[model samples]
Target: MVLQSNVRPGLTQGLIALMAAACGFAVANVYLNQTLLVDIAGTFGAAEAEAGIVTTLTQVGYALGNLLIVPLGDIFERRRLILALLGVVSLSLVSAALSGSLTWLIVSNFCLGLTTVIPQIIVPLAAGMADERNRGKVLGTVAIGLVCGILGARLVSGLVDSLWGWRSMYWISFGCMLLLALLIRLRFPVSKGTASLPYRRLLLSLGPLFMKEDVLRRSCLSQGMIFGSFSVFFTTIGFLLQAPPYSYSSAVVGLVGLVGIGGAIATPIIGRVIDRKGASFANKMCMLAALISFLIAVTAGHWLPALILAAFLLTVGTQANQVACQANIFSLSASARSRLNGLYMVCTFLGGALGSYLGVWAWTRWHWTGVCICGMVMIAAGMSAALGTKNGGNSHKR
Candidate 1:
């Protein structure tokens, strides 16, 4: 029988609330650029495809920050790092709000993404706090908030843009970051460990985990490919909806993301399945579900309800696989948890960053058919990666 870690810890309710708040606000930064891309393009006198870079550059910043900033949680006071990150994100949001040029807006957006590492920090922190038996459930709750923040950002940004303009979205984000920073500073516990390690070595050590560990490699690669597929759908859907007989407004296109609400709701259910049945089973199901969504997306053009259902299925796959990856990693070791999460997320975000650019480029050059094919191909790649790992045995191998 496996020895479960502490099933219950004496952590406070206040800390849990603060963690959820931090995740909610932090994830909003990743997607704030999505709903506003068209408006930003118009404001900057830029092409739509070029404006798509706003999302890509922000994700690029996130990928880099994951590599550089998240490992510091193991060596620094997690609370201090979290607060500082929120401060940087707030300032970046303000800069984005005040930008007079497209170049400046994109730069500020990149900074915002870099500093949004607050959620990443909080996830490891939450895992370190919860007991093994309750780990998936606790983390699932926070993950729910993270997914909600991501989904909600697009919805609110679009709705706000409809009412007050796109600039208002940044201003509102600035306020949310500011308030969450204060709450976190006052409520969350400070975590200080491994402070003696040199920062450079701390970052360098994560490389070996990939080289020696198959489970870690597969986890990172699976997430990377899954997110790549997700980015392909979202990045181009705006153009698709605005063009055809649908010809939806930015608000309508953004509202389409509400489909992810089902994924958020399914997190606890997926967590339970992983806790009882194991991650391998859960991972396989997620990969197959995502592949089906790709097929649905490819063949169901101009059918609003079918396309919406496909979007929901795609998000469900992404979130389930994400939960499996987290559970697999956190179950491995307590000491290296932060570094492990940092390494895994950097790869995943890099996948997302590539997908954003690739999706936009495909749409521009080859149209929606090309973009759909790209999404299908990425999902198939993810399924193949999952198949390669099925008989590898144990979540710790990768």
Candidate 2:
């Protein structure tokens, strides 16, 4: 595993934990708005459907960042790029907290998403630093933080909103980003980028890179669809829980995220399975889990326990599938990992943006039933794409 001359030593368990923490803190910013959509809409006297745009725009900004900013990881010093983005995201969170109108909040949230792509940057950095023999295990450990941040964002935001107000959550997140930046500055080692390509060519390379890599294409499609379903579930679940048959408080909705810990606990084990059984097998298993989750959710409209069970399964599926897909793509190119990651994330978040929009659309019409059906359709499509691929036998070779 050759690396750039200035690349730091291989990951320590402590460094891996810090990378995981950074990924968690940075990625949490993108999701803080999910559970707060209802409170935000009420505060601004906007319709639920109108407020849904906040989630969609955040995802759109993330997708754009993956396209425009993440590829820079290949050209610039990664720690510097990461810390700079953290500073911008901190300011964005403050802007969100101080937003005077829904429009203002929406714009600020988009900025937050645009700058909150530190997790994506960190993943490639970690992957590059890890030993090939245990790369899956390292990635899975880091993914635990990613998973926790994503699910924990809902839990934290919901409680903060319930106790203080929706805006308070942003204030807390702002402080978190500031603290995260300082820790990263102290703890992370400097690693120069491998690629020295001109900026324009760096961006242009994404097209050819995507076109040339079969594993990259399949991984993108499978993960995009699964993440789309993930977006659909989280985006609308709060609204459903707050309505009839449940009439739950925001705090209760947040607690549902805690229930997802069952899934988080399984990620390391999935990583080991990927190491032993291969990413293709893990991908298929994850898709099946996701499909069954939606199937159960379709009948969970009136049952809290069933809903909880479904959420757990969905979390496991989405998080495991992410590990599998990322492991698959990162194995393809040592030098182009960042660019490949950028293309892959761009598609994944585009799917998320679409899911956020579609989830709201379905909720406004057919409610929870509609959201479940949308999720099922996405998982089914992802399964079809994964099954169509012929890479299953060779996926473990790397």
Candidate 3:
């Protein structure tokens, strides 16, 4: 077993927990608008199709931020950059809350997405600071916050919209962002190990880095596929739950986010596995679990418990696979940690967008069974890519 001592020692569980909470807080901004589209449309007197632009612009901003801003972590002081971005996020949220027109809301949401790269920065920082012995565990712990934010934002936004109206959600998140910025300034340690490369060079380096690294390429594709499949399930589950035998309400659909906790809780446990058995073990299980979950979901359409179990399994697999892939990615280039991470995120988000689009299309055409089939195919594709990489190993990186 080899341990890499890369950064100065100061990481603690308390700091880890705060970092996790901050990440959850920051990343939640991307999703807050998802559940509020209807109310927003009503308030602005916009059509449903026009209102959909809010989510579209948010997603675009997120992708652009991942590509453009995240790599700056390797150039600037990470904590300072984070604090600055938190300020941007706070301003964006407030602007969103006070938006007077659809156009203002759209631009504000885009800015909100652009600056919410804090979680991405924090993840690589956690990996860069920890040795292989504890890297997976730290990343996993932080992922709990990231994953929770990803799954829980819709619930929070939906609840707040019901209670006070859509704008209130932004106001709450806005206040929370300010508090997180303060706590981060006070508690998070400064880590700036990257060379003083020019910003253009820093950005340019990502291209060759992505093209040249076998491990990174593999990590991106494998996780991208799994996340794509994960997206498929979440994207279409509400439709399934609302129709036919289980005709549940939208609130009940929101409760389904709770099922995703299976993955959140399993993340650290999976990290332990990556530590003891290597990340490959977790990666393998990720593909397998995803494949199995889809099979179960396909047959269990009429049974609520079965569908819930399928959702749980799908989340566990995707989350575990992601943690393992990311643990490996962070190890690949200590100095390039943020760049690698940013690229990984960009790929996976693209995959998720693809899955969301495809899933909706499948549901529109063939309903539940079609959605399950599409998810299964994506997971299978990931598994196939993994198998072709090496003998007895898709996690050929570690």
- Most accurate candidate by TM-score: 2
- Each prediction's whole-model lDDT (CA): 0.81, 0.88, 0.80
Tens-place lDDT per residue, model 3, 154-207, is 678767877788899999998899889889999898888486789899889889
Where is model 3 more than 4 Å wrong at Cα? 1-8, 37-53, 99-104, 242-247, 389-398
The alpha-carbon root-mean-square deviation between model 3 and the true structure, to one decimal in Å, is 3.7
Candidate 1, residue 340: lDDT: 87
Write candidate 2's Cα lDDT for 1-398 as tens digits.
34323224656777888888888878888898999999999999999999999999999999999999999999899999998998899899989999999999999989988888898999999888877766778888899999899989999999999999999999999889889988999989897889999999999999999999888888899999999999999999999899987888898899986788677777888888888888888888999999999888997656888888999999999998998888889988889888999999999999999999999999999998999999999988889878865555444544
Number of backbone clashes in candidate 3: 0
Better of 1 and 2 by TM-score: 2
TM-scores, all models, native as reference: 0.94, 0.96, 0.89
Kindly report the root-mean-square deviation of model 2 from the true structure over all alpha carbons: 3.0
Clashes of 2: 0
Consecutive 10-residue window with the lowest summed lDDT within model 1: 1-10
lDDT of the structure predicted as candidate 3: 0.80
Q: Write the per-residue lDDT of candidate 1 for residues 28-94, one digit (tens) a residue.
A: 8898678788888888899988899899989989988989999898889988888888878889999
Query: What is the Cα root-mean-square deviation between model 1 and the actual structure?
Result: 3.3
